[model samples]
Target: MENKRKELLFSREDIQNRVKELGKQIAKDYEGKKILAVSLLKGSFIFAADLVREIDAPVRIEFMTTSSYGHGEETSGHVKVVHDLNMDLKDYDVLVIDDIADTGLTMEFVLEHLKAKNPASIKCCVLLDKPSRRKTELEADYVGFTIPDKFIVGYGLNYGDYYRNVPYVFAFVD
Candidate 1:
């Protein structure tokens, strides 16, 4: 096994600060509104956990696990919801959180699906946005970073379902 390299894309402090900023913005935007934070699981877990604690509002949390990368390090354009949320998203402002936005195909599909449920509003928030790889014309309401088009893993992101325990982002050289 190749020893994973250490690269500091976003430090712990950096994540904390940005999440606080996002929380502040979210709090302000959805003050007194029923907010439903729908986190794309296994990846956005850490980010969603931290972000929700910072928000000073009445918010609900749910998780959905969708996978498009089966045994590879890239997307397959097919997202499967391994787990689904149990919340009834009727009149809430749904905020979809993910670790990164790559092809946007999955995000687009999820957003459209949720929108059809007659939610008051729906938005997306991603920890990283690799716009260079986007195949769909979707944007995140809150993005932590606009990274170069490279395979990265850490801070809840992963490679081969590994390296997500790393606290910082590192380029995975395949």
Candidate 2:
């Protein structure tokens, strides 16, 4: 598996530190508010778990499974929700969590959908932001890292759903 990666982009320690910092910022931003963290599933699960632990404020965690990339490096550009949120989002401040924002289409779709539910406010928090690949005018409110355009895998990011369990993030060589 090591041969499949060109080099490490982020070490496990680096990712941990960044997540902690993001949690602190989030805890401060929504200190006195009702925060409902909607974690976009499969990819962001690991990150969401770690981030929520660092936050000092009370937060409700929910999972929403949305997909745009199906076992491929690039998105299909057609976003679909495999599973929707079960809890009511009305009057709750929502923080949508995602692993990476590559094209921004999936996040846009999510935001539009969640907006209809009448949440108090909606913001995005992403672990990685690939601004070079963005096809829409959307930005994450909290970003852990601004990465270059590369086929990254590991630390909950994957290629063909194989490398997500890797502790560090890496760019696929081939």
Candidate 3:
């Protein structure tokens, strides 16, 4: 069965605990401010949703879809924005939420694009940080888990579009 080929990485309880902690930290950081939470789509949808719920401050949500131009394991940092932001970036603190900071190219591209709009301030938060595969020096302000270079799925990361709805994270076994 398909279940036999996977090992649990982060359980549902583990994810919930961490997300709660991150939410508290974020809320405390921006205690007197409003946050324009920009969530990178596809892989980040679920994590962003859960994360925002934990924040105690005023949070507004928006989404961006981006894809990196790469052929294989080595990710070329060039990113193409499929959907651009419609928010007025001048009024609030911008927080970019992503599923995983893999190569960092996509995050870098996104940050640069947002910087042009002149937000009050900008920061990145990711559910997983895979520093081993990073091609750029971008660091997330908040990271839930620093994972190894492995094929992980669940909680918004998909395994051929099926395992995304899984409550926890797991690694595929050969």
Best by lDDT: 2
Global local distance difference test of model 2: 0.92
Every candidate's lDDT: 0.86, 0.92, 0.90
lDDT of 1 by residue, 29-133 (tens): 898889999989888998888889988998889888888877587889988778876656888999999999999988898898778777889999999999999
lDDT of 3 by residue, 33-85 (tens): 87999999888999999999999988999999987633243455668999999
> In candidate 1, which residue pairs clash?
none
Worst lDDT run of 10 residues, candidate 2, spans: 1-10
Compare candidates 1 and 2 on lDDT and give the better one.
2
| Runs off by more than 4 Å, candidate 3 | 1-4, 69-77
- Could you tell me every candidate's TM-score relative to the true structure? 0.93, 0.96, 0.93
Model 1 bad stretches (over 4 Å): none
Ranking of all predicted structures according to lDDT, beginning with the best and ending with the worst: 2, 3, 1
Q: What clash pairs does model 3 have?
A: none
Top candidate when judged by TM-score against the true structure: 2
Error of 2 at 27 (Å): 0.4
